[model samples]
Target: MLKSRLYELSLFLTAVAIAFSSSEILADNTSFITAIIVFWFFSTLYFRLRVFYKNGNTNIEYGISYDLSFVLFAGPLGLFILETIYRFTVYFYRKWKKIADPNEFFDTFYNIGTFVITNSFVYFLFQHFHSSFQSFPFGYWVLLFILVCISSYISGAIMVLLFGTIGESITFKEGIHFIFKDISFLDYGKVAITNGLLFLFLQEGKWEMIISLFILNYIVNLSFYSKSQSIQNKLERDQFEQMAYTDFLTGVFNRTFMDKKMEELNQTSEKIGIVVADIDKFKRINDSYNHAVGDKVIQHFAATLKGYLSEDDYLFRSGGEEFTLCLRKRDFSETADLINSILRGVEKNSVEVEYNGEKTSIFYTASFGLYFYKINELTSIEKAYIQADELMLQSKQRGKNQVSMVNGLITKELV
Candidate 1:
């Protein structure tokens, strides 16, 4: 945290210094500078061409600003002014919108600081290249292309540092991979071409044409940005829904989803098999090893059950060390066969857990109580669930690892 703050402060101070030192180069025509700043500010606000990617825990969101051309034309003073105005405007805009962002405050400073410093660096390079190469051997277009690529590379580095500020530690290899993952050479060429055109019109004092070109670019960018945002919103909704219904540790449907599903099933006149299964001597596992090992065992048990499920079957972690299986489109005999096979599979498989730096296989068993019945108006799913749970308790009382139903034990013994 301290390091991040220091880095931000350094960048901010350096940018301010550069802006102040270049005060002499303020454009003679104040109106041109004003127009540039206004366009740049609005472009940053409305035009965002963003690409999203996932690299492990890091979510890399890359936006193609294409503002480098204008920045180069504006110089240090203009760059700093534009960045400051845009950052502050965004900060206030979010506040007005009642958006609760934890990092918004730091982000405001970080963004302005980073952009000012980076663009100033790029501007310096542009100036150097322009002076050194009077008539470029490889042509000016190729030179612009190379500069844009270099700018992109630098931007990626700054993004990595931003991640570090937020406490996301990534390795150098991962950083490099992140930098190049979604970036296209074609996009870099687009940046070069656009900037070259903008620079040409600016030199010829064709402000109206420059405005037209910027408006065209903005329209194109807004279209793509809208599509990207829509896709991103849908993905976020799906992820949120999954998280709501899924057990955090076991990766199965949680009790909340089970209840909702049961309500839906009760509305139908279909026969469903409800199997309530509980790990035998589960409390002992937590006491003997640790909660971490206990969690491992639970995950392994859930995976084993999941492997046995067909398309018509659903498994849920209804309680701690307890799971519920709903078998649709299966008769009593078929359900019995499946449950018996699961019982045998549980006995055959063992979970490997680490204890005191030593790995050991822990063989365990589970008891199940199945209630096969057709959903009707007379019997509510809540009542049926209670009946299934009571039968599971009966299995627990009958000396642990066995399936008990209304008729009695399916098997004489399961060890």
Candidate 2:
């Protein structure tokens, strides 16, 4: 917590210095310049604080504006305008799902283009608003914006070429390790930052300032790039930890994840239903055929089951031959039909394999046990899970390849 706060303060302080320095260089009084900087920088810091406080998720809290500096904002009003536009763009894309990459590139390429375009546009608009900078032609301003955008794209693209998705999220601490991970992003940031600074210096047609700014951009990008690599390593390690909770073969919750998710669902207002399933005579298949064939049968069984499920429902491989499904809505009927469809699908479809110099078809089948309980009322989610497990065992006893309900209300015949 202290570390995050300190980083936040550093960002705020750095941004403030940039803003003040820019105004000092301009030597133009726009009446309310000081107030604007205070408002803009503070507002940015405030948003950053709120983000860290509310969503502590690393991806959500600092991924967006962590690297951006104050000079990038131009002014408080400019900051507000850019943020509002970016936020709306994000919300619209997510809400309607119509938003797409304006620039076509895969992975880190997309972010490179996005960041460059945003910076160029913001700088262009902010410059146009400045009365002192009005001497420059609109076309000249546009040309400069395009140049800077292109430079940023190329430089940031370095990160893409080097580390791929690893370059996307870099904090100050991580910026150091970026040196070894991908120096391209460093070059990119350097060129972009320096180019912008050069443009500012060349406003007075000073050759030395232009050269100095150019060098500065390179140095800065190199430094940040180093940190970025370090950060990427940390993030990757964290993601590894997250994946530990997920099943390797199925890409769903493992027992560890299931326990955690069930705990969360127990605290919710809505009810959660737990369904347990097992492949009928799975051991016989492995014994009679082979584990290799058995594995294919398992994959086929899981794939069929996936088709019957709703988006909200979850599928899990509890162990070899044993499966679990968590149904969010719907009563036993819906879950029953879905599970039954999966069973029928598995029965109808067979995986063909060549063994002992002969080609043959392999069939797989499963039995399901499902139960639902009010999530709001459950003292524990284990109640539903245990009952569902017992019900699954009961299905094996009643007959193979059928769904049994443990909720005491609805049950289905296995045949």
Candidate 3:
């Protein structure tokens, strides 16, 4: 189902309203805590500029700003202010660099609402459980910290799932899967360790720990960014290599791939089988209908050929209306059955085309020529192709839809 832009906008506005309401209950305190929060927020922005990580459909940098806001402020109002500052800073930075994407403009509100709502609930739970932080044991403090992290993650995940489903028609299950997959253990560990360390520093009144932790966090973010970039580059290279060996129209192996496979086979001493086939009256189909309909017919024929191939077989779109199949470790009878099955499938299938608002169906068939031989050198493959091509011409001459087999270099016609 497609989602309307107006609906998405309405949802964003409603979320912003809720977050604003929640921020009204926060206690206003302007002191050293506020200054430290501001410093950490800007430091997060600086590290964010150095490393941008893609999570699901959005790019989000790992930062301690959210953790700092939740741990230091302990109030809804302060968390809201810190979240607003961080979001606007990132937004203006993108605008100044002329890299602002309008599609992502709504994310600022969504993220703010998520942080305010989740952290506010965590603070409420923390207050309910602990009578006073002064007398709380260290073990209890650690438990409370873990609870905050888990609850914050869950609440944020739910918000993301809700917004994603409303905006993009993504399923709840898919959203959950994406969220879990995107949040690596490293992300959780970084947040837990940094926030825990910062909490202890505040308790001990140690100001120097701030700079040390910031540098360490930045180095870790940089390392993750480099690893992700390397993986992305390798995937792109593999895609390009695949495209080079694939037929774009038919989605089958191309002539170049066939050549490479033949070369590989030449190095082995096993017997190989080759089948060359061409659609009967393919040019007539194009001339009568149109090139579009001809393409549909070709795609259907390719699918039919693919259905008859085994795991050890390879199919290639050798020409406009011609295909070549390579079969290994198959005897003459097995090869004949496979070739006959392909011919039968092609004859039974039909291609549907729409012309001038009306639908028409067309059926087509192909002629096959099979050659089997032992591969000793590259020339053996070349010779097999020549023999198969000649035998295919014989099948086309005998009839338009029959198999002509060259058994052990002996020409034989099979219907």
What's the C-alpha lDDT at position 88 in model 2? 44
- Candidate number of the best TM-score: 3
Summarize candidate 1's per-residue lDDT along 228-309 as a digit string, tens digits: 7899899999999999999999899999999899888888988777889999999999999999999999999999999999
Looking at model 3, residue 291 earns an lDDT score of: 94
Tens-digit lDDT track for model 2 on 1-415? Answer: 3443343344334434433444332223342244233333433433322222221222212222311333343443334334434444444444466443332112222332334344544454555655555557764444444444443444343333333223344564454443233325444444345445544553454546644543453455456656777887899998997799876766666788777777787778565568887888988988987887788777777777677777988777788878788887877566567667777887788878766778879876677777765654523667778888888888888887787775433333111
Best by lDDT: 1
Clashing pairs in 1: none
Q: Give the residue spans of candidate 3 off by over 4 A.
A: 1-70, 73-85, 103-117, 131-190, 207-214, 263-269, 348-361, 378-380, 407-415
Segments of candidate 1 deviating more than 4 angstroms: 1-31, 43-67, 71-145, 157-171, 178-181, 185-197, 204-209, 212-240, 267-271, 281-300, 329-334, 352-362, 373-400, 404-415
TM-scores vs. true structure, each candidate: 0.66, 0.49, 0.72
Who is ahead in TM-score, 1 or 2?
A: 1
TM-score-best of 1 and 3: 3
lDDT of each: 0.78, 0.55, 0.69
lDDT of 1: 0.78
lDDT of 1 at 284: 97
Residue 162 accuracy (lDDT) in model 2: 30
Q: How far is candidate 1 from the true structure (C-alpha RMSD, Å)?
A: 6.8
Clashing pairs in model 3, backbone N/Cα/C closer than 3 A: none
Residue 254 in model 1: lDDT: 99
